[model samples]
Target: MAAMKKKSVKKKSVNKKTASKSPCKQKLSVSISHDHKLGHDPLAWLSGEEIQSLSKINDTVDPMTFKETKIENEKIHVPGIEAEKNIDQPVALEEMTKDIDDVKASETGSLPGDEDKTQRTNEDDDMLILPEIFGIAQAEDMHGELSSLLAVSGDIEIDASTIETLDASALQLLIAFIKECKSSGRNVIWKKSSAKIDSAASLLNIGTLLEL
Candidate 1:
């Protein structure tokens, strides 16, 4: 009976020790829920006023146009020029258009007052200038004038500035005279012409042929 009692006591002690060890070796767990307070809000790093100020600041971007991209007084290099630079934008459209028109007029020989200046009589240049009214009314006088001009050893110059009209006969006579001058190796300059000459030549469709 004593030995059975001692065995029972030993078993009870072992059971108590096992119960203590089970409580000590229990697993630890952490849980979070919507009701849980995190002490401070995560957005507390930015103040309420700071967040509002940032939202008020406009961060939206705007699109750009071609004219806006070009800087004022910017220059562009042109080819085949003497390192000349042209402005990127035209200062005045009227001025630019006027300059372009002037260039075109010069190329087409149509600039205002250019004909008078170009065909002006050079009295000091020793060129043989014809009489002003080379009219068919005095066709014999014109013939005599031509004979005298051909008698000279130099080139001939015709001053047609005072002529107001040109008849068919006069036109034919002028053509024959020019042809004869060319055949004789004489340089004939039809200098100092008026608008009347050009008008008459154009009416006959012989402006280019007569070099009016």
Candidate 2:
């Protein structure tokens, strides 16, 4: 009977120790109620004055509207779009030629009265004034004038006082002109003579031939 009582006590103590070693889980009661709100206000922390200030900002600040700028009769080059070419635009050819002519006239240092003087020289065929520089370049033009003078029935008066340079070709042209005048029954009269003319003619041993 004592051994049975001791076994019962040992079993009670073992059960107590096992219960103490095991984990104890408490029951969690979660109850869902329809009285609870679904969505909470995100701006619930903002006061009435702050909310009114935000409303005023929303009313005053306008939403940006992008406007397409229309350009009339102008070419807008876009990156991907091919530009239309107007190939028929007339070139200012006459104006370009006029500009080139003006440039040439300016470079040559021609005066306005030069044309009138040349016209008079051609019309009158009486007096021929030699330029300050008489070169081979001017020989052809001088030949033309001399030929014209030869055609006219008048005594030709030559002014050589302004001749600063006299080329051999020019002296030759003058000699030919004097000879032609003599042959054409036209008198060759000297309106003015210069030492330059005389020296050039003498250097060529043709002073008597030029009647200088």
Candidate 3:
């Protein structure tokens, strides 16, 4: 019995020693940076020229030298009154304005029918005779003539007896003129229109508007 008890105590001590040794013998974990490839360092990729360029990026600058240069300026001599005679004189504003007015007169001619406007005194008949050909070519003259009549401030008669060719534009101008006459409270008398004028007025369907 004594030998069996001593054997059991030795077995328990062996188990306790084994447990303590197992805790102390546990493997210790080590950490390593894996940012780069296995055996290559990032700085090892740079060549000697590249390292030299990087080193030069922070190198000190050399002292600068500046040389002074003296420039000789040539003096210019200008002629006084003699130079003024050689230069062309500028045109006066009044002359330039006159030239512009002359151009305008040449382009558009004297206002409408002033060239052919019948000059009549108070004793003459108060009638404006239409030209033989009443078309776009004559509308401007007719307008000017009618406007002049309006300025006269009196009841007027329009002689339409000789309108050989009456166009739509001319008819429109006559209709507008008649309207203007009526609005100004002025009387307008039509001295017997030609057959062309009557046909043109009917074709445009403005006979009623013109009070024809």
The candidate that achieves the highest lDDT relative to the unseen native structure: 2
Q: Write the per-residue lDDT of candidate 3 for residues 1-212, one digit (tens) a residue.
A: 01111111111112345546894543332222222113222243244232223222222111121122222233333367455334444455664455533553343343221332332222333587877887897677667666656554567787889877778788888888788878877778887767887777787787787677
Every model's TM-score: 0.37, 0.43, 0.42
Candidate 2 structure quality by residue, lDDT tens digits, 1-212? 00111111111111334445762422222222213222222353354232223233212211122122222343445445635633344445654555534553443342332322222222444788887888897776677666656655568889999999978899888988898778767778888999998887778899787876
Q: Which stretches of candidate 2 lie over 4 Å from their true place?
A: 1-123
Q: Which residue pairs clash in candidate 1?
A: none
Candidate 2's TM-score: 0.43
Best by TM-score: 2
Task: Give candidate 3's TM-score.
Answer: 0.42
lDDT of 1 by residue, 7-64 (tens): 1111111234554589454333222211322312335334533222222322211122
Backbone atom clashes (below 3 Å) for every candidate = 0, 0, 0
Query: After TM-score superposition, what is the CA distance of residue 9 in candidate 1 from its true location, in Å?
Result: 99
The C-alpha lDDT values of all candidates are 0.48, 0.56, 0.53
In angstroms, the error of model 2 at 142 is: 1.0
Candidate 2 has its poorest 10 consecutive residues by lDDT at 1-10
Error of 2 at 192 (Å): 0.4
TM-score head-to-head 2 vs 3, winner: 2
Better of 1 and 3 by TM-score: 3
Q: What's the candidate order when arranged by decreasing TM-score?
A: 2, 3, 1
